[model samples]
Target: MAPQSNRVVELRIPSELGYEKIAREAVATVAHRLNFTKEKVEDIKTAISEACTNAIRYGSGSDARMKVVVILTADEDKLDILIKDPGASGAPPIDIDIPDIDGMVEGKRRLGGMGLYIIRELVDEAGFVEAADDDEGNQFRMVIYRVEDTKTESSPEASASGADNGGSP
Candidate 1:
């Protein structure tokens, strides 16, 4: 169980392409409720989609039985997202050598390894972390810091959907 916070949403689903939307939707919902801007929420959604795709296609080998769990935590100043994939085995240590965005944009470097790069660019901080204590798995943690905005206002659609009512999942 996660510590009590302003908002927390947890989602678990099979490790398959068919379930990616669930993860994205859950993240988006939590982010929206946390008062994130639409663009930031979309960025979180895209990054999460890539991470989950890698987890399903590579980590779990597309196994439908394996589970992918996503936990979204939000406070007044930050939103932390953890995406866990309990694949066949734990992932080897990851050493992310910083990629040169300029070179990649200029076609000097290949465009294949942009998932993590894009994630890093999108969020304030992002990294892989140890999985749950009892679970042999890999976890990707992404953090986004929220800037204080006194004028921040919820859209009518979000208000109509009860986002301002402080729901939990």
Candidate 2:
């Protein structure tokens, strides 16, 4: 952890699968300093990895020349993760309902397209920033509140969740 004063940390890496290790390590370190539970830390690590992988695979299409920027902001009660894909055209809006976990685990449903679902499950809230048709970047954002134990809780905000509050125009 740099200093408690430095609430936001940024990392930019080539959009490749190999560099994902760095992302996981950085995220875990920050999350640990925030005193998140071990299980929560592991979940955040996994979710971040999945988000990065998806950004590389689907966003940049594994383009080595493109870049992925991960911004982690920690506050008194929550952590916000924003992943920007420089080459992504933004995901299309989807109207499908959340996948049924039982069916997914039972092999009755398709296996792909589970990253976003897993992210939504692991974090307090999840969202996407659609790039404009003329824009060059898209974003995936996640919000996780400090969950030291079952009794602790925090409120979710549109800004942190990247909801309809002008994350992208």
Candidate 3:
């Protein structure tokens, strides 16, 4: 078989409330082309949507004049996504915390802070990349593996069966 090459797709969208949907659709098309399963594709789409929404709302302050950049790198094994925003709202959060849904519903905690947490859970890896001295924006990255082997030693079933029991027998 021929060697697989990496394919990249870049998109620039205005930093507006509704622009995230554009990114959502674009990622869905790319993920489908990479032959990802329907569930995985849906996950990717949702993850990208949340990330882009954060970039638009917080990173660029939802300023339509600002632009949010999305870069997707597709390889045989995985897909890498990077989102760049103008950093108008200062630095990105250093850590992600689970949403306080109960508090929000009870009018104690503020609503709509679950984007990062959702993104983290949906993607294999999700984080804000540190920028170099010359860089001026926040760069957030997410990676999703294309294939997952159900019978691997790390699988839940294998672990439950003690397949990695360190030769205790």
Candidate 4:
């Protein structure tokens, strides 16, 4: 496929626990076809899984009747993913905190809530897209570049930790 051309794949899965696996496998195939490295493909898979899980569980409340829509836009340079849910859980989080594993183990914090953080770390860009006036639910977006750009490299630590990493990827 031409580098400038785009291929789009859309999937609508039931709002249930195991359905996210479908999206995972579909994204993996697309990433491989786009010539993404093995490591990057793995990252994309995990990120999509987490995003879809969040959509099914929190976004649609696992209603089963509701459907979670996943849109995969494959380009030569990057793969863009958009997941839409019915927003049964209201607004998505404004911030993604570094997972407090220690606190969770110590019984000071909740065990889950790490999905968004993990997605942010794995992909080049990840966040909930602002919905339009007529839109009803949440639209989460994630983008993974096939090739890393060293010039614009930015570490996730700057967002997770207040300190900067001197532009390390």
The window of 10 residues in a row where model 4 has the poorest summed lDDT is 160-169
Error of 4 at 39 (Å): 1.0
lDDT by residue (tens digit), candidate 1, 1-169: 2224668778888988979889888888777777778998998898788777777766677899888888888887788888787655445335443466788899997766556655655666567766667967777777776772321233333222221211110
Worst 10-residue lDDT window for candidate 3 reads: 160-169
Best by lDDT: 4
Prediction 3 TM-score vs. true: 0.84
lDDT tens digits, residue span 15-118, model 3: 99989999899998889888888988998999899899989988999999999999999988888999999989887776455577899999998887887766
Ten residues in a row with the worst lDDT in model 1? 160-169
Model 3 segments beyond 4 Å from truth? 1-3, 149-169
lDDT of 2 by residue, 1-169 (tens): 4345548989998998977778899999999888888999998898799888877877788997988989999887778898888645555334323556788789997656666656655777666766567856767777888853322234334223423322211
> How close is every model to the real structure, measured as TM-score?
0.71, 0.73, 0.84, 0.88
What is the RMSD of candidate 1?
A: 10.4
Q: What RMSD value applies to candidate 4?
A: 4.9
Which candidate achieves the best TM-score against the true structure?
4
RMSD of 2: 5.4
Error of 1 at 95 (Å): 3.4
Clashes of 3: 0
The per-prediction tally of clashing pairs is 0, 0, 0, 0
Candidate 3 backbone collisions, by pair: none
